[model samples]
Each structure stands twice: as C-alpha cells, then as structure tokens.
Target: MSQLRVLRVVERAHGILSSRDADAPDVAQVNEAHRSLRPEEVSKAVSACDRRDFLSMSACSLATALLAACNSRGPDEAEKVLRFAERQNEVVERWLLRHTAMNHARGRIAGSAFPMYFISKTLPVWDTATRGPWMLDVSGLVDRPMRFTLEDLVRLPARRQRVDHFCVEGWNAVAEWWGVRVSELARVVGVRAEAKYVDFRSFDSNFHESWDLESATHPQTIVAYAKDGKFLPPPYGAPARLHSPIKLGYKNTKYLTNVVFMAKRNGGYWSDQGYEWYGGT
Candidate 1:
C-alpha cells in the first residue's frame, strides 16, 4: 500500500460533503451521512477535519449547538469534535488550509541538541552485508544516469556539516551529517537543462518528496550516510538519506533509494496534506 493511503480516506469524506446541498444541509441529512460511514472512516474524518467545517453548514443552529456541547467537553473530546466538523465540510477544510502557518527553512548551524524522531514504524534498516547490494538509482532528465552503491558514494568528494533540522510538527534539532553533496551528484549525472525539480524516493512505504532544482543542487543538500561521525542508525535512516539544510525535515526524505530529476512539480507527502510546498529557508 502507498504511504499516502490515508489521503484516500480524507478524499472520500470530502466526496460526501460535496454531494450534500451546499446552500444548506439539514442536521438530519448530515446525521444520516455521518451514520452511514464505517467506524474507521468516521475516525479518519474526525481526525483529519477541523471545526470550521461544521459551522459553515446551512444548519447553523445545530452546528452552533454542537460547538456549545464541544466546549463543555475535555480538550481531547473538543478536538475530536472540531476535527470531525472539518472533515464533514469541504469549505471548512479549505478555510483551515488558508489559515495554516508555515515557516521557511532556516539553514542554521547546529545547536547542541540532536534528538531523533521517526515518522513510520515500518522504517527500513540494513547492516553492512545487507546494504552491500543497495544502490541509489539516479535517473530522469540526466545525460549520464547511474546507480551508485554506498562504497561508490563514499569514494566521491564528501562533506560534513552541522545543520539545524526543522519539522513540520513544530520541533527542531541540530546534528552533524557527512555525505556527498547533491550538486556533485547532479554534475556526475549530467543533469539536463530542462530539469527543474528533483524527486526523492524512500525505501519505507513509498514515502517521497520533491524539491526545486536549485534547492536540490544547493551546497547544503547531500545524500548523507553518517550522523554525528558514525554510521547512521536505523531509527535515523540507515545506509543513506537525503539531507538538506534548506528544507523542512520531511522534505529531507530518509532511507532514500532514488533521485529523479524532472520538469514537473510533484507534491510531497506532507505537502499534499496541506503543508507548504516550497518549505524553503
């Protein structure tokens, strides 16, 4: 399954909202729609939506009552009500998207902290023997496409730097990384003139991200194999990962397996989920 399968559930919820009478959907109609959803689907709708959606419905009286009821609940219960509302109304979701706050990547020097955070439980891990057969496939919009092994990459001119990492989840960490600069990879691959973006693919759950060609080839962008002067651990993305000081942590995809230069803009995992697409410093 795709790493983004949850997006489908969100999309389905939107479909239900769209099929309703936009001018005003009655509370009974809305209730029927909610009740028709599967238990897991209802959870997805609630978890994925925000409060504004419910308020925008034509049945304002019912929605206002729901809001009042929500206020009397605990924080967790209130949040669930708001999320359910957001998922139930498409207009509300769009409004929330417009109001979201996003920060540009800072590219700052590392501070002392280096806490690690992993997103998915199904992270790909490899030992020296297991990684021996692993190779990074570099293709698309390049003259000299190549597959590079870990040893092959280590032989290239390598760089090390301490960079501040910012997550979309509102956390930051600083760590030292060692890897071959992405610009060198571009040069070695003979990137074509029309290539305007670089798409990175991960080994875990088909997680992927794309960056503008300029950022992709930036000096601070590298395919890192080591962290804090040691081989990267599995929790930190072993074998190799894409690292960039000028992008959000999500944009710096981990367990990187491929790099493809292309002309079109491809939305990333979180970016598709309403995060900033540029995500630049």
Candidate 2:
C-alpha cells in the first residue's frame, strides 16, 4: 500500500479510537484496513506520522495497534519495527530538548564514588610527558579555528551547575561542575553559519561523539575542568571534558582533545554501535 494510503488508514483509526461513541462497526472497519497493510507499509506510515507531528497520544494509540499487527512477523521484521520505534523516540526527545529546560537543581553531590567509565582498560589521562601539554583543538566549519590550553579555558567566564548525570546502564549521579560553557566558546571562535553539528573527540582510545548544534550549545553544556570545588581528577576527565545534563553520560566525551564543528553528524563511539544518536537523558 502507498504510504499516504496507510497514513489515511491510521488517521481513521485514531479518530475512531478518540471518539466518545466509537462503535463495534467503526472499530472493525479500522481493524480491517489496518490488517491489510504489510509490516513495511505500517513502518512507512509510522514514519509519515512522525514527520507530520502526528505521533501525539491519539497517533500513539493507533501506532500501538498497528505495531501489534506487525509483531507476528519474523525476527527481521521485528528488528525493523524496533528501529522505527527508536526513531520515533528520538523525534520526541529532540522536540523536548528544544522546548523545555533541563532540571539543573543543586542536588547532593556524588563525590568520589561517581561511577567512572572509559573504553580504555585503564583510566584515560593526558600523558603530559609523552603527548606534551594538553590542549583542546577547536576546528572545522568555523571562521576562527583555535586551540585552547587548560589555563586559557580557566580564564574564560565559568559557570557552575549542579545536575544529575544519567547513564544508559540505568545508573545516575549528581555532581557539581565548573567550566566554560560551550556556547561561550562558540561565540569566541565564530562558529560558521553552516555548522549544524558539533563533534567532540577524546584521547580515550579515540572515543568521540557528535551532537546537534542546539544541544552542543545549550547553556548547561560545558567543557568541565573542575568538579566539587577541586580541579578535575584524572579519572573524571582532567585537563578538560564535555559535560551536560541534557545528554546521557556516554555522549559527554572525556579526556578531551578536539572539538570539531561540522555541517553533518559523524556518529560517536557508542552511537555508531547502535546507541541512540540523540542520546538525550
């Protein structure tokens, strides 16, 4: 079935489901139309709903039915359905980030035991002896590509935020962070009009993550240099690291080395391996 036709059927289903006087006859007709669509057709219809901003509560009711119909198919089709659902989730998350303010309450600090993680076997640290002094290189799609030393970042206006950090593994911690806001750096470097995404690279086995420009420049997003009133410890991304309550823990790259403003997203360490690209908390 054509995507447009599928959408019409889904919309009809939504209307029937929403009606106070929905009758057996009306529901049966909607069911008949819905059952006639193949899994791919239903997927396309859901994508269409997402594009049209029809994934509201009404559309979700219809989608639940449509997905239920497709669930009988084999595992490959089930995987496709999963991907479609994840995409819809990303759409909702991006919309929320754009429309709402993240909770920045000064919660109790997690302190030394805040779960430490890195791709490397040992904690990734700046090898001052081998790699020389640590420097943050900001380049790509900006008028003034510049590198900043730790001292330079400390000299810039700093913001302190106490926020919760959520991990994909279902653990979370609250910490106090002090750093220069990413938006301030953008202003100083003159980010180009064409740069739609920001890529943060790390020395942690070349781990990196890309973010939409909006999230990258959020007032809460920062290259953190200190935590809980002391200079950042090596295990907690000393020298500098990206930190934001707006994104999941993995999205905030640690052991930072480079920041690239890009015209397109280049997937990050975990995101490239099937973690959601948006990675919103």
Candidate 3:
C-alpha cells in the first residue's frame, strides 16, 4: 500500500510534466530527467525511509525542474508565481477535503510504511512513562510566558485538519493532524504587538525553526500533538510538533519544546544550510 502511494505520486508527477508547456526549457529538462530513470530506478529513488534518504531520492527527481524554474526570469514572473501557487493550493485543499480520514500515513517514500525521516544525526528518546509531566514552554516577547504540560495541551481547544505536507525535496503526503492553533497559544502567552517572528525550539538536537508572526499565528498553524488519531509517533515528532499547512515539511519542527516570539529571525536548522528562510508552500 505504501509503495502504491509512491507510485501514484510518480504518476502524478508525470501528469504534471505533461500539463507543463513543452516548449519551456525547464519543462523539457525536467521531462528528460524523469524519462532518463528506469521504472526500477524510480522505485528505488522513492523508497526513502528517513530524512537523509528522502532528500537524496527526491532531489534526484526534482533537480531538473528546480534548475529550470530558477533559470526563468521575467517581468510578469511574480504574477506567474502567484497564479501557480494559487493553483497548487486549490488542488491541495480539494484533495484534503476528499481524503480526511485520520488514519494511514503513506507517501512517495516507498520502503517505509511510515514515511517520516529523522534528518538529525542522533535521535532524542524521551521517557514515555513520564509523559504527563512533559512541558511545552511558550515564552519570549510576550506579556505572560506560560508552560503547558501534555495534559494541559490536550485540554486546550483542539482542532484537526487533514492537510498536504510538502517536503522541500519535492515529495508530499496528506495526514490528519490534531492540535491547538498557534494563535490560541499566542493569545495565552499574550504575544506582544511588536513581535515579528515565532521561533520554535525543539528538544531533538536543540533543533529550531522560525516563522513570520503572521504565519505562525495563521489558523492552519498548530502545535500538533497527534497525527491520524493517535499520539504522534516519535519519528513524526511525537509528544508535539509545529504543523503549518502553508509551510514545507522542514518548517514543521518535531519534538517541539518551546516557542519564543521575537523581533528578529532565529534561523532554522535547515535554513542555516541554504534552504529558504521562508519555506512557504
């Protein structure tokens, strides 16, 4: 079933290629690159069980398209980009509405039944037995810094949304995520008017991500506790994670420990490595 999902994504990519302007250099290059891969090789490439593997496999598949996209420059480029984004958003919204089941995690990453990958060198292991006492601290540039335990989070007003999760490496999956909106948290913490960014600090390797204050407070941005009706699996950032529908997968930091509202940016782990600082979808 998982493999089938990956295959479907490949098929969808092929469809996207067909719909693209054939005369466009980027489209032609992308088409050629995809065509160069044998079926077996394509299958192997999509069999990503973890972060490093996912990036490696998906990069090979998306490079030509990325290059072609980067090469194009024009006066109407900004308008074209906006329209392109709108179309993509509409497709994702429609897909999410059609498939809202809070079960099953499937994706382009083939081998893994659960497609989440830990990109970090070492994984953080929390004592499951001490779950209730775990805390999520919300502080910085707020009138009231607050610390909430898992019990507290569960008790807060929770919302669930089935949204498409896009990886920067160019693969996507849909999952039903349940948690409190970041705005709700911001309210509780009394976010200051001057705050410009919300920095998310994670327990795993002290990993961190920052987002524009508006994006962080967007209704679709949540401090997620569960995916698919269950407590988030460790690989998927169990206990809690920052989930934003508008952002790429890397922006959704796992093992989330603290959210610090600030005036300036605190560059994210991946952003430090040349990934876009604003990883919007």
Best by TM-score: 2
Candidate 2: Cα lDDT at 9:
83
Q: What is the C-alpha lDDT of each candidate?
A: 0.74, 0.86, 0.76
| Best lDDT among the predictions, by candidate number | 2
lDDT, candidate 2, 174-254, per-residue tens: 999999999999999999999999999999997999999999998889999999899988888887899998899999999
Once superposed on the true structure, which residue ranges of model 2 sit more than 4 Å away at CA?
Answer: 1-74
How many pairs of residues collide in each model?
5, 0, 1
lDDT of 1 by residue, 1-281 (tens): 23244444344445654565474555565556555656655555557544455545647887677777664444455666665664565343333432123223355534335555446676566545965678999999999999999899999999887776777667777688899999999999999999999999887776888888877877788999998888888777778999876677889888888999999979888777766666764
How are the candidates ranked when ordered by lDDT, highest leading?
Answer: 2, 3, 1
Better of 2 and 3 by TM-score: 2
Error of 3 at 191 (Å): 0.5
Supply the TM-score for candidate 1.
0.59
Name the weakest run of 10 consecutive residues (lDDT summed) in model 3.
96-105
Model 1 segments more than 4 A misplaced: 1-119, 127-132
